[model samples]
Target chain A: MQIELVYVPIDAAAVLSGVKAGEDGAVTVFDGIVRNNTKGRQTRYLEYSAYEDMALDQMRALGAEAIQRFGVRNVAMVHRLGHLEVGETSILIAVASAHRGVTFDACRWLIDTLKQQVPIWKKEVFVDGAVWAPGEPFPAEIALG
Target chain B: MRLEVLFFGVLRDRFGERETLAQFPGNSVADLVRYYRVIAPELGELWSSVAVAVNQQYSRASAPLQNGDQVALLPPVSGGSFRNIHAD
Candidate 1:
């Protein structure tokens, strides 16, 4: 189980190396890079923030869940905080398993659930202006609003 | 109870304070939100849309509060919506 939240620029090769193993037949990675545009607007950069303590705990839970639900050998997740320039990797997830099917499923599930349950937030900086990226509504069960 | 209310994302920008320590006159998270809304009406209706996190977990409005509890107001999260990125 490997889960991390960092402020430094993400190194893709370094992340990939963590999951590379001789016994594992397949490794699936999800590289969440910052794009240059959003909804046709030219974006300059992005800023990510999180409630650090809780965010890390939630991420660890997600990694554990992926291991159990998908039968993956190991899971690694890293999300960068603070300012991020366009094309920089903002988040990365690497999942290793004996087969390709579970690796893909766990990798996808990790990212999707991270967006939903984790406390991290992102703000989009546009060329002309800036706005906090509109996020999906919380599930009715946990929503306070 | 003295509670520290935390703001993140747009809420931080709106409140103009990253975190504020205040005496919450009520006992639950809902009371705290209502109490602060009066003091800072500038937050307006946006106050109602935020999700509350008690000590880092997504908490319901009626969740009871204790002195020194760290309550965070969270806006919507857009982290995984990166276009041209490998999410799926």
Candidate 2:
């Protein structure tokens, strides 16, 4: 299991390589990249920030949970922080499993869950202006009064 | 008691990265939220939806706070790419 929040670019090839094992039959990957536009507005770039310590803790727990819940052989998740240009890789997730079915399920779950739970935020810089992308509300269990 | 309060995302934009609160009278996370609301009335509605972290852990409003504890105010997180059709 590997979970990291990096300031530099995410090496997708290296992350995939690290998760693969001889025992694994399938290695599923999800590569999330920065896009150049939002709601038809041209984006110049994006700025990502995180509550580092808490984000890492949440990520580590999710990695462990993915392995046990999906019965995957290995899981590696990495998210990049700081400035990112369009088309740059923003996040990468790899799940190795004995079969392809579980690997796909695990990979999807990892990304979806991370978006909702992880303490990371992104600001989209557009030609007109910049705004913090609205996020999904926290799950009721985590949201406090 | 002095508490180190950290802010992230939009909250950081509003409150800066961190602030030191001296002689904090609040004893719990909720009290801290209430105090913030009092000071920054413009952010009154925003406070209701935020999640609190005490010492880097997810904490409830009622969780008791200690002197010198590190508290964080987190707005909703938007980490990954927005998956709307136009986003791609």
Candidate 3:
């Protein structure tokens, strides 16, 4: 139920707290962080940008889908924008459900779907150069000509 | 009509700007591409593989565009990774 596109570092603890519910038996979190290298190149940092309005809308859709598909009670997703250093959290997803199994399944589904569908881009700055990381193509239905 | 087109990631770098206001002569996304080709040929090469978003949703090249519509050229999404605790 909480979806944000933030420039500041993601507060994973705060996001997790938002997903807490007394009735939910389990909560699963997927925390994505910035790494130090890509394909053997030493990364200096990363710059993330988004079609912000669209990205937020797409994220909201993902959270809603998780609720409908997996019967999860709450879904919290936060994605960071702007520059980030190594070891910084980039994205976080927390899913609460009545059972542990559904929580895990929903958490996985949310991140996977967000990666493919959301209009967010990241560029890796290596010591030698900076390049945009090639991403997976969108599904046929949503892809433009 | 004038359309405000946004460029992101590599596209932003290619255009050397984040957003632009374009004078669109045609109605569809393809028309916008054609217009851009005349002004910036380099962008044509990159446009072939990009996905266009209209009003914050995935849109097709054939989708009609109106004045003041917000169109964004999305290169690709390199997000959401668990490998080595980082993003791609």
lDDT of 1 by residue, A27-72 (tens): 9999988888876899898999888888899899989999999999
**Complex DockQ, candidate 1:** 0.49
Interface RMSD per candidate (angstroms): 4.5, 3.2, 3.7
Point out the worst 10-residue segment of candidate 2 chain B by lDDT: B79-88
Tens-place lDDT digits, model 2, residues B1-88: 7899999988888889999999999799999998888878887667777899999988889999999999999887888765532223
Tell me the spans in candidate 3 whose CA falls farther than 4 Å from its real position.
B18-22, B37-45, B82-88
List TM-scores for all candidates, in order. Answer: 0.91, 0.95, 0.91
lDDT of 2 by residue, A61-97 (tens): 9999999999998999999999999999889999999
Top-DockQ candidate index: 2
lDDT string for model 3 (B1-88, tens) is 7777888878787675445566657899888766666776765546666788887778888999988998877776777754423334
lDDT of 2 at A14: 90
Candidates, DockQ: 0.49, 0.57, 0.51
Candidate 1, residue A2: the lDDT equals: 66
- Evaluate residue A126 in candidate 2 and report its C-alpha lDDT on the 0 to 100 scale: 91
Assess each prediction's global lDDT (C-alpha) against the native. Answer: 0.82, 0.88, 0.82
